[model samples]
Target: MSQNIFIIVCIIFVGLLIIAEYRAAKRLDSGFLKWVAKPAASLAFVLVALTGGALDTTYGCWILIGLVFCLLGDVFLIPTGARTFLAGMGAFAIGHLAYVGAFLSTGPEISGLFLIGSAGMAGFAILALRWLWPNLAEFKWPVTVYSAIIAIMVATSFLAAPGQSSAPNWVVIAGALGFAISDIAVSRDKFITHQFFNKSWGLPLYFGAQLLLASSV
Candidate 1:
C-alpha cells in the first residue's frame, strides 16, 4: 500500500508540475530551502535502491549526491524551464557517469550492443530530423542538448553489461534499455502532442525504467 501510494503521489506530483508549468508559462526560481521534498524523495529512492540490493551489487553513494541536484534542478527550473531542465539533464548525465563507474563492465557484446543501441539512436534521430524537425525548428539551440541525451540513452543498455561475475549481461542490457525507454517517454511528454500519453505512457515508462535500474543492484 505504501508503494502504491508512493506511485500515486509521484504521478500526481508530475502531473501537477506539467500543469503548473503550462499554466504559468514562466520559470519560477525556488529558493534552496523552499523545495526539500524533491531531494528528500531522491535520497529516499536511492536508499530504497541500495537496501533492495539493486543490480545484485552495491552502488556508489555519490550517485545519490548527483540525484539530489537533479531533484533541485527539476523543482527550480520549471518556470522558464530551459536552464533548470538543462541543469537536471546535467545532473542525470553525471549520475549516469557514476553508473558507468559502478558498473564493473565485462565489455558489452559489441555485436548486439552496437546493432541495437545504434539502430534505435539512428532511428530516433532520423525521425526527429525528418518529421519532427519543423515542429521544434524554433528551438534549434537545444538540438545539441537532445542529441547528447540520445547519446547517453544509447549507452543506457551498456550500464548493466555483465559486471564482476555477479552482474549478468542480460540484466544490464534490460536495465539500460528500461532507462532509455523512460527517457524516451519523458521526451514524449515534453515534445510530443498529448497529455494522455504523459499520464498513461510517460509515467508508467519512467517507473519501468526505475524498476529496471533498481534491478541492476
Candidate 2:
C-alpha cells in the first residue's frame, strides 16, 4: 500500500480499537463486544504489519509472527477461566519469544545500552514477581517464566537499537517499553485487583505498542 493509504488504514483501525476499549471498560461480562470487537482491534496490528511489508525482511517477518501470536493471545483472553487465561499467557509468552527472535535477526550489539536495559528489566522483574507472588497461587511458576521471557524481549530490543536498520531505533524501544509497562497493569488487574481502571490504560497502551511495532515494518 502507498504511504497515504497506510496511514489512513491505521487511523481507521485505531478508531476501532478505541471503540473496543470503551466496550471493555463499560462491561464486565463476556459478550459480542468481547468476542468480536476485541479480536478485530487486535487483528488490526497484523493488517498494519502486512501492509507495511512485514514479510519483506527477516526482522519484519519475525515481528509479523509475533503480532500473530499476540492476536491469538488476545482472543484466548476474551473468555474468563483459568484454562483460557493460561492459554492466553502461553500465547503471549510465545509472542515475546518471537520478538526476541526479531531482535536477534538484527544481529544486535552488546553495548552499554544493552547491559543497562537488561539490568533494569531484571530489577523490575524481581519486584513485579515479588508483588504478585502472594496471589499467584498455582500460577507462580508459569508467571515467573513468562516474566523472564518478556524481560529478555525488552532487553533484546535495547540491544538491537544501536545496529538494526529494519526500523527506527525509537520505534523498537518505545514499543517494547510500552508493552512491558502495559503488562504491569494486566498483572495488577488479574492478580492484585479487579478494576476497570487497569483495562482503561492497559488496553490503549497495548494496542498503541502493537501499532508502533507493526508500523516499524
Candidate 3:
C-alpha cells in the first residue's frame, strides 16, 4: 500500500513537472526552473520503479540502471552546446544498452515479433536519417550509430516472453516507442528547427515512456 501510494505521488509529481517544463520551454527558457523540473520529472519515474520494488530482480536492477542513465542524459542535455549534446547522446546510448541488457536478462529468443519490430524500427531509422543526415554535419556517424543502438533496444523488447499477462514486454515496447518518438522530436527541434513547441511533444512522450517502463517493474 505504501509503495502504491509512493508510485501514485511520483506519477502526479511527474505530470506536474512535465507541464511546468513545457510551459517554461515555450518561453525559450531553459532556465533554472526548467532545468530543475525536467530532471525532477525523470527522477520521479526512477523513484516509481524503485518504490514499486524493481530492485528485487536482476532484470529490474538493469532497468533501474537504464533509467539512471536516462536521468543523466536529461541533465546533460539541459545546457545549450554541442559538447553537452553529445554527452547526452552518449548517456542515452548507454541507457539503451542497459535496456537491451534488461530485456535479454529473461533469455534470448528469435521470434517473428522481434524480426518484425526490428525491421520496422530499422525502416524508421533509415527514414529519420535520410531527413536528418544532411543536417547532421560532423555528428552524422555518431547519430547513425546511436540510432541503430536504440533501434536494437526497442527490438529487444519483443524478445520478452509472450504468454504471461504480466510479462512487461508490452509495456517495454510502448516505452521504447515513446522514447523513439521523443527523440525524433528532439532532433527536429535541435537540428532541423529551433523552437520550444517541440518540447510540447517531446517532454510528455519522454516522461510517459519512462513512467511506463517504471510500471513494468
Candidate 4:
C-alpha cells in the first residue's frame, strides 16, 4: 500500500541520513533532517494503524500521536546540549505515558504481565548497577533510572490485549533493550565518562528501538 511504502521510504531515509552523519563525523545539518523524517514516519504509523486492519481506528490514531511526540523529542535532542537533551528525555517520557494510555485502552488483561515486566525491569536495574556501576562511576544513577523506566514501559506493552497478536514481541523486546543500552552509553558519553564510544551503535540502537516500537504496534 501507499502507507507501507511511505514507512519504508522513511526508514531508508533515516538509515541513509545516519550513514551520512557518521561519514561527516560531526553532523553537518543541525538535525533538521531528523525533524522532517520523524513526522513522516509517525504519520505513516498512523496510516498503517488505521487502514492496516486495526480494530479501532480512532484509538490507533491517538496512539500514533504518542509516537509523534517521541519523534518530536528526537528532534529536540539535536543540539547535543544539556537542556535540549533533558527536554528530549522528557518528551520521550511523555511518549511512554501515551503508550501506557494506549495499552490501558485494552483494559486489565495486561495487569499480570505488567507486574512481571516490572519485576524484570527491577532485576535488570540491579544487574545494570552491579555490572556497569563501577565502570560508569558518575552517571550511574541517571542511566540506570532511565533504563529502568524504559524496561517497564516496553514490557508493559505485553499487558495490552492480544488483539494485535500479529505484533512481533521480539521487535518490542529489542526496542526495550536497545533503549536501555543506548541510553546507558549516552549517559556515559555525555555526563559520566568518555570511555564508551560508538555513535553508530547509539544511533542505530536508539532509533532502531523507536522504529521497532512503531512497527510492533
Query: Per-residue alpha-carbon lDDT of model 2 for 71-178, expressed as tens digits?
Result: 999899877799999999999999989988888888766788888889999999999999999999999999999999999999898855423353338788789999
Q: Which residue runs does candidate 1 get wrong by more than 4 Å?
A: 1-41, 52-80, 100-109, 162-168, 194-196
* TM-score of candidate 4 to 2 decimals: 0.70
**What TM-score does each of the candidates earn?**
0.61, 0.89, 0.89, 0.70
CA RMSD (A), model 2 = 2.7
Which runs in model 4 stand beyond 4 Å of their true positions? 24-59, 110-115, 127-145, 162-182, 192-197
The deviation in Å at residue 26 for candidate 1 is: 19
Question: Local error of candidate 2 at 100, Å?
Answer: 0.4
**Candidate 3's residue-wise lDDT over 133-217, tens digit each?**
9999989999999999988999888875422443447878898889988999889988899766777778778888988787777
lDDT of 1 by residue, 1-217 (tens): 2334444454444444444434333445433332443334343445445555443544434333433444554454333366666666666666555555444343444465556666776676666555445555445546546555545545544534533553335654565565555665555555666344444554445444543454345
lDDT of 4 by residue, 100-208 (tens): 6665565546456567777877787677667667765444665566566666666766665434563425555565567667766665556554432455577667666
Once fitted onto the true fold, the runs of candidate 2 whose alpha carbons sit more than 4 angstroms away are: 2-30, 161-168
**Regarding lDDT, does 1 or 4 come out ahead?**
4
TM-score of 3: 0.89
- CA-lDDT, candidates in order: 0.49, 0.82, 0.81, 0.60
